[model samples]
Target: MQKLIRRREANPGVDWAEGGLHPLLARVYTGRGVAAPDELELGLGHLVLPDKLLHADRAAILLADALAADKHILIVGDYDADGATSTALAVSVLRDFGCRHVSYLVPNRFEYGYGLTPEIVELAITNGSPDIIVTVDNGISSIEGVAAARDAGIRTLITDHHLAGTTLPDAEVIVNPNQPGCEFPSKNLAGVGVIFYIMLALRAELRRRDWFAGRKEPNLSQYADLVALGTVADVVPLDRNNRILVAAGLQRIRKSQARPGIMALLEVASRSPHNVVASDLGFAVGPRINAAGRLDDISVGIECLLQHDHAAARALAAELHQKNQDRRLIEADMQQQALQLLDQITVETESAPVAMTLYQPDWHQGVIGILASRIKDRLHRPTIAFADGDAGEIKGSARSIPGIHIRDILDAVATRHPGMILKFGGHAMAAGLSIPRDAYAAFHDAFVAEVELHAEEVMLQAVIESDGELAPDDFNLELASALRFAGPWGQHFPEPVFDGVFDIINQRLVGEKHLKLVLSHPDSAQLLDVIAFNIDPQEWPNQTLSRVHLAYRLDVNEFRGRRSVQLVAEHLSAAE
Candidate 1:
């Protein structure tokens, strides 16, 4: 698919340069809607007060009561990275606060699907027989599951960050920022962030009750590491509050103050804790833990996070690392198959469909989300990939582009054509659903029509937003290093990317698929190192092209203790 490198519009209201920011960075920050200098402050004090989160205090009261009464507490967690981190954070903190009977159960995706399903509730009862069920990272839509727990005489507290459906679950307390009537300023809290806030509120409740007079109080900041990992892994918007959480977590991880599990995972992923950043957590550490949930069982991930011993955590990290490797292989095979299907479909149509729905009976259920995401990025269309589910149904993982809310589309489909979609829930960019296998054609048509109705024609095309071009002097190492750390950037708050034309002094293939090149700008004679990962093998090494336009990020490449400026290419094409 073709891509357009468009520069972001500068925000005229904010003057970051006057606020003591680097001129180049000032422009970049202002372009991202930084209205004031204080917005860049990522301290813990800048985080939104926990009191503002709806039902958080109520949930805290329930947890404090459970702790004081020595009630058995069972945590129901989802099976992804966010769920694993949320469960580990909740279990670790509650235990640290002296809850002896607290334990967690993450439903296997293969057996019970998602959320606090009735089956999961029964499993929790058979296993832990708890007095209170605390759901972390999920349960916003588990209406029947909460009812089942209630019937079994167990109270439930739901802490989640997913967008709530029209009918909320009947849990005893719900602490989601996105829930109706909530006043939490930042609605983009990831599941782990929500639970962390609840724990913070719980600590305050315990403090108010004078429960910490004799017992040592746990520093909630210690769990910020977990919050950071989950928040980034889940790809939530990095608003001011989330940035604080992630920054604090990165600080702890860099200082080696994080838990053994995180350190062990970083070690296995060859990421030194001293230089860890949000992207490392997103691409490296998060994936290893998520691999267990995707391929085998998420308990391995939860257990890894819960480990206090370095050796034990390392063992589990190694196992998770293997799972991640297996998951990559599976994802690669599935992506190839999906692309082939897309090719056939394209040949039969005048233009690619505005939305895509793909199904293959043999596709791995665990890898469909990634496949959907890959296809969505490749074609710049809303894409859903389905894998065979139980009996006559198929499960799909959907990924969407900007300006197209996937969950809303799914909701519309469900509303317009009842029973076409069995169930669905998620955020703007991603969602999951199930439907009858026989309804694939009809659902595909309905989904495409919905997307066409809601999405603008411009959004259907791939547009790579850049921070414009860099000046000759701006391409130095000092600026590159500054830009690298200027952000714990991800999702809504993007890392800076720039577009410019460059003369290709050298070009070759590295690692078979990656393109490595030495290039010089027309305005400067100094050559810079550049590399583009996962480039098309057939198109690259084009000795035919001497000049090219590149959309790239200024990156600092460190090789054997030597650091230099490097350009990480986002998009490259022949310069007209």
Candidate 2:
């Protein structure tokens, strides 16, 4: 492992001390390019209102007319955590806004694959016979499917957050931050965030037209909890706009007024809503929703989010909790098998570049993407995994290192072998594709060739940024809580990681592979509990008195009836 310390510096356009932030916060904000005190304030007033978002008013108008006519409206959602949450948010808010005939359909990873495929569009037509279709977290890449919807006399409204293609989809109202002509400042809004903005605009339009004169206009802000859950879960950059959404949602969650489903999920995960943080969403709630998509039908997740009844939501949350457990077991088995396959491929003598492509006749298709991620992390190389699909076809998911773009690599393969890949689309880091089983070798070779052109790029050392060293005084509960509330942190705006040198006073193995260590810093003579999850026991140092460097994030761990600060160790090494 390589460690490079990069100092945080103020952006050229930003003022640090004059930004009216706490000293530490000012440093972090300026490092992230915040120029004014207004950028640091997370008040809802700072949020980009619906009208400020381009094409949002037009989308609201289109939706209002559809609702007035009582036309059937179908929501097409992606099969991931963000997609599920976006689907539920749109369906619930639309119904709350007086849309009489609103329903949702999520594509099965096994059958319909991903995104707004022509097959999925046809499925929606057959099942719901909708007059209009709204896509969430998907459809930006569904050029053919949008055309098909038009041909079927269905108006398409796409609300997605994915990177747009060269040719935009022919939707009646396209609400995407990544669209070429769109000038939305925050390009990191999750799919759920985009849908939430549309709801805000729709509500505004209803009020302007006196559509809800007699009835109460639903407080659309109530759904920010869902937005926060989806945005953090989707791993989008926590830009200024996204931070406002998450901060507002976290306030609702802490007040215990979050959606019943989110509350029930909190119960199942043993996390208190009153103390919910971004980590809770990423670890506890996000995985449960993602488990439904990875192992079973994602509708289970959507139901958990949409079911307003407490009893029903609890039961569904429990079911999803169990599904997540089962998913862990399945993923463990697949990962082991993948490792074994890697061991069998002997390429030591060959100068062929290292790129991973694995296909299994029995592997579950839904979990291939996750398995690809696991393999990529382990080997530090671009990885793709495929599983047998219907009628001798194979479905594959690919994940890439920081430098290589997975979708571009797949596109190059497509160009090399015309008509070989059935369908493929995604962003730079992750992608999905399908091909006949017989063409797997050709596709794999083409991908390897493309990756070889960027070998130096892929082999670059990893850069790990730290928030500098922390004294034992900084480990207090007050400082930890302040760090937690410093604003939403994910992807780009990273959660603060601290590094320090310590002596291991005590050590033990706990819960199979976890290492529990008592580390003491000499500066203040303070001892801290450090837990390294899934660490290899053989790698533990033999000398207890030896100095060691540790990289970790401070977390408040609650056990039994007590709460205390602990170090969640990410990496560690013996001090030179």
Best by lDDT: 1
- List model 2 lDDT by residue over 1-576, tens digit each: 334445566555655556455556565666776777767788888897777677989999999999889989999998899999999999999898888899999998877777887898889888968999999999888888999989989899999987776788888989988888788888888999999998888888888889998887898779989999999998887888898999888999999989899999999999889888887898899999999998879999999999889999999999999999998888899998987887788523133245889998989887888899987776667889999987978989998877788888878778778988987887778888889999999888888888888768425444566766776677887777777777677777887787878888888788878988898987867789999887767776445546778888887778998889999987787776
The alpha-carbon RMSD values of the candidates against the true structure, listed in the order shown, are 1.3, 2.6
Q: Candidate 2's C-alpha lDDT?
A: 0.84
lDDT of 2 at 476: 81
* Candidate with maximal TM-score: 1
Model 1: per-residue Cα lDDT over 432-538, one tens digit each = 99999999999999999999899787887798999999988888888988898888899899999999999999999999899999999899988989999999888
lDDT scores of the candidates, listed in order? 0.92, 0.84
Query: Considering summed lDDT, which 10 consecutive residues are worst modelled in model 1?
Result: 344-353
Tell me the lDDT of model 2 at 468.
67
For candidate 1, the TM-score is: 0.98
